[model samples]
Target: MPRYARSERQALADLFQTLGPDAPTLNDGWTTRDLAAHLVLRERRPDAAGGIALPPLRGYAERVRLRIAARPWPSLVDQVRRPPAWSPVSNPLTDELANTMEFFVHHEDVRRGRPDWLPRDLPAGLHRALWKRATALARVMLRRFPADVLIQAPEYGELSAGRGGEPVRVVGPPGELALFLTGRQRAARVQVDGPALLADRLRAARLGI
Candidate 1:
């Protein structure tokens, strides 16, 4: 079974619990409260504001707490099924999968500075799924980066630029590779071996995140 939903939720909840009083910074200067609000709003009003909605920052923390308390396990699957109530926004499976991947990745984001926040265990199945999603997203994002570079991580097989500089090698288990590419975790289980310069460039870009 695809355990992305449950595992992702567990990870996020654990991260929140671990973070406690200190608010961690997320992408684009958003605080932990902002990140939590964004995640909750996205799940609640997926269609708000062209698939993007911004709630008031003042009460966001409490809102997030309440929202998290109210949500049930099957909410994500239901959200995936229906059209986002917000117009001009669509939730493709790719987007849904990507969101699931983001949840897992961002869990690490909040925990990065706090050592005690690290997850004790990550579900193997969910990790594999995220890796696959990361591979696909990496291919899409590679166009923005140099083609000469290659990423070799055991979690995500060997990804290399193909002819005309398109990413052609997206071979690997989805979860591990996805986490490595995104910078959530180091490529410990896997190794990137090819074009040192390219590898450095890829690392700099942080495509997996």
Candidate 2:
């Protein structure tokens, strides 16, 4: 997971650089300025009882980039050595994991928005780890849907389909599946194997971030 986070962060930073002026387009209607502001807001606002001020976006990204380039090995080690501070928003583990997932998912988001901004490359191990983590997170998110919908992914085999009867089929690669469930990827990534109407309804229900 530590390695995965490191790789994911690197991918995100690379995407940011590649996207350049088009970075904000990644979040559907949001502009690059909006995306930058969103990240800055997330970083500055503490989820815990007491908030710790985060550096500005420009400074934050510079720090992260320098940390990655100069001492990537030590950065991963440091993350393991130091626990993430608590946030008032959610569980630290969940939040941290989500942040990592956000990097990968948003990378796709930006790439999809700007076809010219392709990823240079992705580590094989990082992709596999993301697949595992995304599958687990998808299962958790699927639980909120009605019982009749059967959400299955060949990549992860049969997952807990929640309740029965209201069948809504969702299938795709782990990253696409995660983005689809999170309402970021609206494409036909999730196949409604059962009833299309149910899938439509599920799609209409906006899942919170």
Computed on alpha carbons, the lDDT of every model, listed in order, comes to 0.51, 0.52
lDDT of 2 by residue, 167-200 (tens): 5666665555666666664642556555667767
Local lDDT at 120 for model 1 = 35
Stretches of model 2 off by over 4 angstroms after superposition: 22-24, 47-98, 115-124
Where's the lowest-lDDT run of ten residues in candidate 2? 47-56
RMSD of each: 7.5, 8.6
lDDT of 1 at 103: 69
Candidate 1 lDDT score relative to the true structure: 0.51
